[model samples]
Target: MISSNTAQPMKDIYLPEPADVLKASPMTALEMFFEFRLASGRELGHMPGQFVEVSIPGIGEAPISISSSPTQKGSFQMVVRKVGNVSGAMHALSAGRQVGIRGPFGTHFPVDGEMKGKDILFICGGIGLVPVRSAINYVLDHRDDYGHVTILFGTKTPADRLFTDEMQRWASAKDVTFMETVDRGDDAWKGNVGVITTLIPKVRLDPARTVAVVCGPPIMYKFVILELDKVGLKADRMYVSLERHMKCGVGKCGHCQVNGLYACQDGAVFKYSDIASVREAI
Candidate 1:
């Protein structure tokens, strides 16, 4: 047998594509919207709820969801919250800056398939809106394909609200029923003041035909699920984006493992019935 001098080629799982920051705009005190385009001329081609690992040379990398819909071609966008070392460094970069993007990784929202022609309900808490916005925009962009759409968004305070401009557009649109709430009220807030769960009760939908998508903090899930159930929504009908410390974005790190499932591989988005037995999932 000939001695093999050649080693098997390793997949570039961690290698990143050069991306230029086309624009960056501050959405709130801690969060900002960043737009990027690949220098290699390839599109990110990401679906709703899918994420990419943003890598900064010598700084580090972090998993962030694509906030822009695939329908918007030529580029992709991510809403970054300046919560860590990588993110804080990312925030410091201005437009025309360069960074590395590892993937449009993990599972994506089943928007084009199962969600077609069905009434859609979006329940987002604070930064949860980032990923869910992709689905919301896809539905809005393809309005004829889906049924009634409703959006319920909640934030910690009025000042913490993200995408105010987009919210205004959705609120005024005839296609979607929009409601916003805050956990606490301020002197300036004019809309509802309560947990996001409270907003779900006011809306009406046929549970059989409606698919609910939710993303938020740990405590938010149980309460939201409880309220959705009261309206005849079942676990199987609900899809959620589970937040985890997904490092590899490819299930290699095992950091985002929830029982037998890995959030980075099996999902960041999972049907409620699928993960009902996963104690750590909720």
Candidate 2:
């Protein structure tokens, strides 16, 4: 039997390729974020749902999801939660701070020819919306290139919501549908109050043709997937992003291993089918 915890050593890990910090700012006290513009002015050439590794000297690096869409040129943004050593140092940084970066890694959502003319459903939870934001924005920017779009987002509470300004605009867009929920409601919160799964039932979707992308804390995956399946969306039609402690941005690092597959290289973005057999992927 395969050892579920067998992992590679860090000495074998590969370093991330470098990029420049073009901009940085505070989204919240716990969140210090930045946008990196590749030196070549070339697109990261990534599909939605990929990530990059950002580093501050001496503090090390961590895998952060690319929160900006591939369709948006010039730069890509990553929002880091100030929770640990590396992230705390990142939060103390300022604009034009030089940092190490590598990637544009992981499999991406199938947004090209296959998704065209089909409805798309995005169900994001808390900070999970950060990664999903890329795809949502891409679809929105190229609105005419696809069919109906619905975004159902939920967070812990009103103050914890990310990208409020952009979310408001998305909700009001002529061609998009948006609704939000807070697990615990505050007096100022007028939106739905409950688990995000509760909002799934109200969504109008042709499950056979609709593509659903859901991301959140690992514990939230199972319940959300069950809700999507209840709507008749096939497991293969659903995609989810999995998070792991990653030391290397490339596959060489064993930190992100899920059995034989490396979350850094093989996933971070995966179809339900791709990881369905991988025991720890949920």
Best by TM-score: 1
Using Cα atoms with residue i matched to residue i, what is each candidate's TM-score against the true structure? 0.96, 0.90
User: 1-282, model 1: which lDDT tens digit per residue?
Assistant: 976868887888989889999999888999988999999989898989999999999998899999999999999998899999999999898899999998898888889788898999999999999999999999999999999999999999999999899999999988789999999989988989999999998998999999999999888999999999999998988999998898889878889989889998888999899998899999
Which lDDT tens digits does candidate 2 get at residues 1-282? 977876875552345545678777888767756888776567777778888777777888777899998878888888889888888888777766677766777877777755677788988988899989998998888888878899999988788888989998999998788989999998888889999999999998998778888889898899999898898988888888889987776777588898888887788878887787889899
Model 1 misplacement above 4 A: 1-10
Clashes of each: 0, 0
Q: Which 10-residue window in model 1 sums to the lowest lDDT? A: 2-11
User: Any idea what lDDT model 2 has?
Assistant: 0.83
Candidate 2: pairs in clash:
none
Q: Model 1 misses residue 87 by how many Å?
A: 0.8
For model 2, the stretches where C-alpha displacement exceeds 4 angstroms are 1-18, 39-42
